[model samples]
Target: MNKIKNIGIGLLAVVALSMGSCSKDFLDEELTTKYSTEYFETAEGLEALTVSLYGNIRWHFGYEWAYGITLYGTDEFTNANDLTNEMWNTYDSRLGPIGATTSTGAANGNATSPNALWNEMYYGIASCNTIIANADKIDDEDVRNRCLAHAYFLRGYNYYRLTAQYGGVVLQTEPASGVVRNFTRSTEEECWAQVISDLRNAYDYFEGEVYTYGKGITWTKATAAHFLAKALLFRASERCDDWNSSYKQSDLEEAIDACSYAITARGGKLTDNYSDLYANWTGVDCDIEQLDEILMAAGHNADSSTSGRFGNRTYNYFTPQFSNFSGSWVKRGVWIGGMDFQRCRPTEYSYEVYDHVNDARMWKTFKTVYGVNNVADATAGIEAGDPGIVMILNTKDDHTYDSYTFGASKQAPNWTDDAGRLPEWTVGSRQTETSGSLTAETGQWVPNSLVLYQNGEYVASSFTSQPICNFFAGINKTDDGSRTAEKGDAHRDVTMARLAETFLVRAECYVRLGNYSSAMADINVVRARAEWKSGENRSYYSDGSQAFENNSLNTGSSAEKYIYSNLNMNTYYLSNPDLEVTTEASSLELTSFPSVLPDEDEAIMTAIGASSDYERALNFILDERSRELLGEWQRWETLSRTGTLITRAKAFNAEAAPNITAGKHELRPIPQTFIDGLLNDDGSNLTEAQKEAWQNPGY
Candidate 1:
């Protein structure tokens, strides 16, 4: 095995191991190889064992699992054409169910068996169990408990993940012994009970111990409670079907207590700006765990090797196709990393989640515009007062190929172009909105080209619509050569858990508990942080309407057709030193967004008849989660957990809308390989009926 250098930043210790077979022999080889169980008792051995748990086993969450499975097949994102994992986004039955992955390769468009994720978690559990078993031989008390804490957290976290996805699993509490290992699928009740028991043990290990943190993303008491709280809450939700019990009140109260404790006692706080969450990734923030806001994260490094070097793969998959941008485009690295291989595009419903005019989260969570970086590259004769200087443009599909609409630019040309990185912006003519009239009113031209005028206004000049994953939020540029959409080896570490979500979690619990006022208070904290400061919201219309409807709002295709817009910045138009001379009001035609949703987005929520606080609170939390957590993973699971998978997927995800069904879609079938491999008590192969019993219903 190769050596694994421990990275202190973000608790991302990459584990190195030799490749082994997929059968039982592979397990024996890994557990009894170069380092034996005795190695775990020694100081160096114990440290190595703890670090290994965070290694390759964690890759499932880091690379494909989070990107292809967790984030897709939900309401927010739709599959790009030929996105082989289209089966996931479309719920294609040809996909595997409780067996080895179909010949198509990736289980659902990702990689192998249901056992792939299962193997990832259980492998970690095996190592953790080994550490827990040997902790008694350690000489140092603190080190011993700390080691145990790490193992317990890893096991609990994995088990919780398993129980959440597959109703039950073969719960292995001890280390795998030999080539021939015996295992049985535990009940959902048993699995969750074990998860809670393990986490409680971890938290109790250092009860009252002042929460200390280190470089890599460490499993802390708060981390334990954080996940424990989420698990408890998921169980209490309506989706936890065929549940072991029926006490929603007690289960919810227990969940609420866990959440409240996690919020207050955990010592994490929300990052000041939501955009900062994705910026400066890959252990850039060494003390990320120390901050009260982030309890945990899937650790990663700048290393992007297919053979064991850990890297954040989601950063690569989520980017859109903005590489054709040649002239004067400023500061968009995420788009140019490679081909605009749009894996998952936002659904029409997703675009509506944002209050584009007032909420900064929309821009922070997505990159709507790229500004002119080079003065020489700016279109020849382009003037400061160009119509769409800072706006995004799209070809109106409702009209001819040459016809287009100019959206109000989101960024003002305010910043200086320092070394070709600043002074850019985009307008809002493109987004997926399903209202048939809305769709008819806005679209880009074919052959996909944006038109620039002598005055610098931008407009699309084609009939074909661009791919939907064409707009992404993260811009962490990868190595110039590693630019494939399927392999975005962008070296950045994104947030998996932060305090903002915990607040939303608490708000969700409060709503379930009928604590509307407390729920509102919890929800308001997140809102106030995202609340529009005076200068941040840019309004484009002299019409004084709070709403910024699409081109349909215009009476004719005259010169004034697509002119209403806004930018929240006061000096947003100052791209060059000379443009500063113009008044901000003179550029009023360039701004369209900047309105507060003070009444819980009532205008839009009411339009949909979401009138009651109960109804609106759920919508508020759902929207807030998407606004804050989109593309950061956890979409499909959240919808599934809330029992809204079908309704939401049908409403938003265009590709999956026609195919998704609640019956078997909520739970992915157990990997078939594991089912066939199941052995009877007498060492004989289990019959097909026996294997069937181990699978989820319908699969």
Candidate 2:
């Protein structure tokens, strides 16, 4: 079943829990106020309610599975598996075509299936509404408002997700009364407007207090403002260039104001070490140095009985094989050499775009396997001869097919000529049987030929074979050596909304307004935090030598050469600082550019700078988001907002298919079942225009 159906069932269980109660003696007992509603009436009750809201954030979108599928499926850089293909087919992306399902009696609408992302989001919205309506009735004023704010933020956040995905949706401000609530859709504009207003209410109601989870139910001004900023920013992006749309430029201004408020209130700044922010999953356990950037994070405590099974532990999903050290039964056989598992792998495109040496993020993000040489090292001390072992390539079915064989030798070991080397071992037989007593000249004992069991029997010489490797098998020890912790998940965190994003958003707005100088300033602030050398700033033309002139910025051949050369050089230097720049340093130290450029050059420089700024902003935000929020379920949203869905689709399916057409594949189809169900029911109550409007394009 799909996640939505599962969550729906779970929600019913919660309702059942809410209804069942212990009976009270009516006549004999002394009069006492009922504590049923009172259970959620006090500060402690409200606090638990709010924690539940925060806890909901972790599973907001089933981030683990969604992120893996959408991020890889949308891009040209990564490949999709069967599960991802199933998701992609259901979504708007063209990487996979939709197929039929027997249970639903339709091509796509199994509400019980996990792909019903739409249903899951609304369920969250309903939960938030319950909290909001009930919290207001509490006697404690302070506790009441905090709970209300959290609920408002959650509802608004959920709506934000909904509008972004489905465009227009039925806005349920209050809890549904009946088990089956059939509601009509709201306009996309109406949905966003409601989202804005709800967030604004959260901001206003929680203004004075420092809201925190577990302490007491009070909305800290910071959390409210942060989400408020996010809502505004989303609105601004939608309406930035398209004035005819429901969004307005005022929204952008509001976003900037809200973000500014958050910055001032929290005293937060982006940290230099991007990796550390994610590595420290629990904000409390983070190093002192990293505390500045992490505004607020969902905390997961593994030891607590309250923690869920999938809660805090970084399982086999993201870690490399070596670090896990669990048994072979659970090992996925993919290990990060020394890195931590963050639950997603970077696409080749992501790795290529990064500055490997200076970025620091790349090293912390991925691990390179030493391949066969390392395997040889673990095998009996006898070094495997020529063509030093190449690490086995990890295939799509690596977890299912690959196996370790103990005794294999070259059939032409004693051959000196090419003709002799062309024996069975060199041709069809890449391996030879070795007896347990076969001793090398060095007196090292060879192990008996070890064959993996296939279909419950040993497969002696099968090359293209499928053998399941047990990840939970206690560490393997052979006479050769020992193999422990063979595979593990990677450890990296995905960052979604950070201070740098705010800066870049402001930079984009300033550039649009022709405020070049202001734009440059905002751009530089983010660069400074990234630890890019001050002198390497792209703002100025030369190292305090020549003042920038608008027309001159791109004119002279030397000037063009210098700028292009420097930009490329800087990118190379930043990405790979380990490499030496021998030739350029002799003539001029390229790193010594002036910090500020002249006002005249602001137009031209700002254009170039803005382009760089935008690319960096987009790339950094996406990359950082991928790195920090790897399993957090923001990939699809990021792709949708950025309009990179088709680009991602092409990248992800490069090996198997061609690029998908952009416009046709961007938005998801209104599920066929939803369309048919809606059309068949209650059309008699609708106007012609309303009915037409209800249908999605191409339906």
Best by TM-score: 1
RMSD of each: 12.6, 16.9
TM-score versus the correct structure, for each prediction? 0.71, 0.59
Q: After the best TM-score superposition of candidate 2, give how far the Cα of residue 63 lies from its true spot, in angstroms.
A: 6.6
Q: What is the C-alpha lDDT of each candidate?
A: 0.51, 0.39
Model 1 RMSD to the real structure? 12.6
Model 2: per-residue Cα lDDT over 182-292, one tens digit each? 566776667778889988988877756355433212235656676676666665553223432445467766766777776666574666544334422222222421244
Candidate 1 regions exceeding 4 Å error are: 1-33, 41-44, 98-113, 207-214, 244-247, 266-269, 280-290, 303-309, 324-339, 371-488, 534-616
Q: What is the lDDT of candidate 2?
A: 0.39
TM-score for model 1? 0.71
Question: In every candidate, how many clashes are there?
Answer: 52, 64
Output the lDDT of residue 413, model 2: 16
